[model samples]
Target: MNEMEIVADRGAWRAGFEERVLAGYRAAGCSEPLARALLERAAKGIDDWTVATDGTEWTAVGVTQENGAAVGRIHDLTAPQGRAWAERWCAGQGAQRVEVRLTGGAGAFADYPVRGQNRMRAAAERPELPPGLTVRRLTEEEYPGWYAGEEAAYIADIVRAGALTPEQAKEKSDHDFALHLPQGYLTPGHAFYAMEADGQVIGTGWVNHGFLPGVTFGFSLEVYEEHRGKGYGRAAMAVGEWATRRGGDEVMMFNVFGGNEVAMGLYDSTGFAVLDEFRFMEL
Candidate 1:
């Protein structure tokens, strides 16, 4: 596994990197689409590459790669050769901080690591997810509401953690908000379930379909703080799992901040296991 010798064009580089990462992920018996999604996100603004000598795989983002110094998340990095190649490449680019992020089945190097890992210290405990809360697929018409809920949940958590002032929160929350659901981003059959009590939405969960051939990605569960203790998270997750499996997805996956104990506990109780450990090293 020597460094890639022939650099590829931007699109070609992304595809090549994704293919190699997916191969590694599938070899590990992980989902392919999930791995692809992570790679797509990493390709957002990346440029530069170190082609592998064998011409089969390449180190897509090297130290000499300059796509801006902002935080970057790599979807997967199963190839030790590629990872080592990237390490050397980034070192040459004067990368002050580099994080090798592995998500789904792909991997990438980040110029800046996620700062402060203390936000989710009070991990939500796994409550007994209740029953009788009707869960169903989300209609296109309901996407707006779902998006709002997702934003609100994220904003609320950030505020609760004292990570941002109200003004800062609003500004940060509004940036590229529409990107949450770009056209053709998620399939209609993708599941988005809401827990209703008295005909009102109390909790919500959803799964995003993967870009790879057969993987299904699950995430975006938001239970109002008021509804936190009554087992809603578990219930929502159970519904989500059912929906994911119903969609022909064999494995379901989601990411929780390391400090989020409550979500971790809930997922653990529902038979979810930690597949990998990723750290956010800041510059």
Candidate 2:
């Protein structure tokens, strides 16, 4: 097959790009509003979009910089030689540390070892909570302190991932944080829980509905530093899943950042399977 030509054309690329993103979000069980919000944020860099095409077929991709390194998003890429074209195209943009990301794992990009995010799912199982452990609503008095720490840690992680500058990460994190907790701890569709073991608070987690028709979104799970490695994380997850099932959701799903082996191991051991992934490769 002849090599495809890569050219800039945001107008032609925008529709397909939106379609691909929406489809991926749908598969990951995101609510329509949240998916649209995410799509809007994603379109911010469309000025850098390029189309790789022959006369009969095409794919759209956008490249942008993250912490001085090049990052590319390829949308519904199906052309045989599209990967080669994307590599050269990114390099031409003066990228030494180049990476190409896609919404889902396509065989065409199998060489992409890094996963940016994983949408994983498991059947809701009503496991017995570890002895002497209980999950309870996060009281209003505790919400503020909990969220402050959570947001700080999240911003730090984003910075460490080299996916955004500290300022950008904080802004993005706050925007998303507000979207989920518009009413703070009293948010209508969300449930924030504090995990207690032997009458002592040991961890926290949250879950929400409406992200998908009947799937519950497990939002956050954290075990305090002093509580790490004591199996509280797994126990917290089990309670979360049980709560999800009790709320009428048959499946519980959540997203995990790639390379977070500790979290991944916890989820995998607790019966979760990767339903979809945002795959990438650094060139």
Candidate 3:
């Protein structure tokens, strides 16, 4: 892992760094499209990234200030030298603590809690509905419900995960505000739906088909606060699984924070198996 360089802010910079990161991600079992998506999604304007090589082979791809600290996605975590380089890189960034994120939860099936993230999956079948429960495409008239529900769900999850205080969540909520929910609000690669029971709205779910076949990535679901604990979350996932299956997918995969026991229970009871468990260490 020697000869590592700051490549950031350098001319012809794109070739070496992005390639190494992309290569490392691919070598780590990520599909090419998924690898590119991960790179495209690294924090915008992050000017600190590091790289290591064995001549032509990319040994590591490191970034600083991701969600606020430095970390590396090494191609070979087993190599002592690569891990050593990661330590040096994070320290160079003045990181009080560094966290190495293993996407897709490589930890659940393996050793230690260090890799504790669950990449869950369930085969698509017409999920059984609770008595009187159903789902439909969210109508334009449901904008108010959608807006309120999404905000509450987003804030609740972050707050519960200790990622934000209530006030902070509120402030970040409007980072992408929609003063009004437009009719037919469709985003490519995403679909939103409303869950119903006895013809009344119970919850909202947002879903997307991600790379790696047969997997519908996640359901950003929120049941009205008063309506939770009555099986809406599970029903929402069932509906989501069905939707993905209808669209020709065989498996529906998703992740919830390790601390989200309620959500974890819903998935586990609904037959999703833990494929990975992720753990983060503040180094």
Candidate 4:
């Protein structure tokens, strides 16, 4: 078997890779806006990419090849050609792990030599409220602090689980959570919210306008670890959904890792149905 050649053409591949991955996401039933925003993150250099012989785009941290296959590290891949290309990459590169994000029908193809398969769960409908909690929009002044708290909680969870070292977690957490800012909040079609108790924030969530049209996406929900299983996550989700519905969109969508059973249950109990599943593979 010939070693498949893998090349990184960041300049030429960047835009097309973003578009194709996002397009593949939409084809797999993801909302247009959510797909676009996810792609936008890739475009902003937050992700990387490589092109294959069939014109399929593969987004990842890097790429290589071995044993007639082309291998790459990726966040997601939805196109059939893209998936096949990845398989070839894996075979050729002797990749031990290939993190892939797959959606819809592509999930069934996991038999192609990956270590394990995980589902990416999503909620595309409005969320329901539990009791004794209220949901409200979060203002800009409040988001930064809220985001920081959320980041800390996330880091704490990962550290405890040994999924991330403290230094690695710190580096990953240093983001301007406000980058999406008012767009995820103040826009007439978007809403960001935080759950509060006696003037102190407990959890946070938000819905952004459709990345395209006629569809909306949700993000940024986080609850302090101490507050886990207490219904704060659900309340925050409900608040985001209510805002999306109020903005005139009928559907509200959000994604979760399949292995995150706690979160999957939270969304499931709040009226969110599983519309699609994606897998993350790392090479």
TM-score versus the correct structure, for each prediction: 0.57, 0.74, 0.63, 0.55
Give the per-residue lDDT digits (tens) of candidate 4, residues 176-232: 344545343355655667676656667777566653454457755677566777757
1 versus 4: better TM-score goes to:
1
Q: For candidate 3, what is the lDDT? A: 0.57
What is the C-alpha lDDT profile of model 3 across 1-283, one tens digit per residue? 3454433334344456566557655654555666576567542333444544433433344544433334434322323355556666656656544444454445322332342244545544665656688777777677676767677766666566554458866765655334322232655566677788877887777766653554566646667677888867777777777767765666566657556877677776877665434444344
lDDT per prediction? Answer: 0.53, 0.71, 0.57, 0.54
TM-score of 2: 0.74
Model 4 RMSD vs true structure = 7.7
- For model 2, how does the per-residue alpha-carbon lDDT over 1-283 read when each residue is reduced to its tens digit? 7768766654555676688788876776656765676577666666656777774567666666654456766644667777677777766776544454455455776656554554556455665778889878889899889999889878876666654679878887988899988998888878888999877889888889655666778878778889898878878778767767767776677877656777878777877766555665555
The per-prediction CA RMSD against the true structure, in angstroms, equals 8.0, 4.8, 6.2, 7.7
- Best candidate according to lDDT: 2
Clashes in predicted model 1:
18
TM-score (C-alpha) between model 1 and the true structure = 0.57
lDDT of 2 at 159: 64
The clash tally of candidate 3 reads 10
Please state the error at residue 113 of candidate 1 in Å.
8.2
